[model samples]
Target: MAGVRVIVTLNFPSPEAAEQAVAGMAQAFKPVLQEPGALQYELFRSVDNPQRVILMEHWASRALYDQHWNKQMREQGAPDQEQARALSPTFEFYPQANYDLVDGIWQPLDPADRMTTIRWA
Candidate 1:
């Protein structure tokens, strides 16, 4: 089964709010890290934009990710729709067949995999 990666970007009104949100998220997700099929989960703050936060999550498979999501909704209740909209979060997903770690470097399993290249301006 291919691994699933989700990138979630959140925009806050201020740096203080972003920091608070990050702290809250870290606390809330502590148990999620222990959930089965949870491959990786990390939160990062944008250096250039203090009001921005990024959540990087990887699941062992799509089914596992869905199972986690369902469990969260069931346990925590569905998030308030209006409140969630106010946060203005964006999300993206990537499905990868395999990954490799060579010489402390992470890369796709297939040598010919055309990974996206980011060119910083």
Candidate 2:
């Protein structure tokens, strides 16, 4: 079976700080991505979240990914994605959603189909 596309977002104090974090992250996930099920991991610093970062990852299967999250306790031997996530960071797992329903992949808003406000319900 295929896997899910997870967007892990983070924020920094300033643009300079974000840049530094991005660089640090580039080297941090080296060992992580090498692990099983960690198919692909990409880091992105958003224009909106100048002080923030995003991690787009793809896994071989949700089970393996879940194992990584549940068992990857640096407490045992693994590494924390990094030490920067302690700053009010959170994650949302939308197992039902992917880029298919969304038109543009990276750019969420398309000028041709832009809407003023969005309502979840």
Per-residue CA lDDT of model 2 for 7-121, tens digit only, reads: 7777676789889878887986887798788878888877766787888888777787887777666436654566545545666554321223344343224342234223353
TM-score of each: 0.77, 0.59
Q: lDDT by residue for model 1 over 36-107, one digit each (tens)?
A: 889888999999999999999999887899999999999999988887787798989887766666667665
The TM-score, computed over Cα atoms with residue i paired to residue i, of candidate 2 is 0.59
Clashing pairs in 1: none
Residue-level lDDT for 93 in candidate 2: 54
For model 2, what is the error of residue 48's alpha carbon versus the real structure, in angstroms, after optimal superposition? 4.1
Error of 1 at 34 (Å): 1.1
Model 2 lDDT on a 0 to 1 scale: 0.66
- Candidate 1 residue 65 Cα shift, in angstroms, is 0.4
| Candidate 1 local lDDT, residue 99 | 63
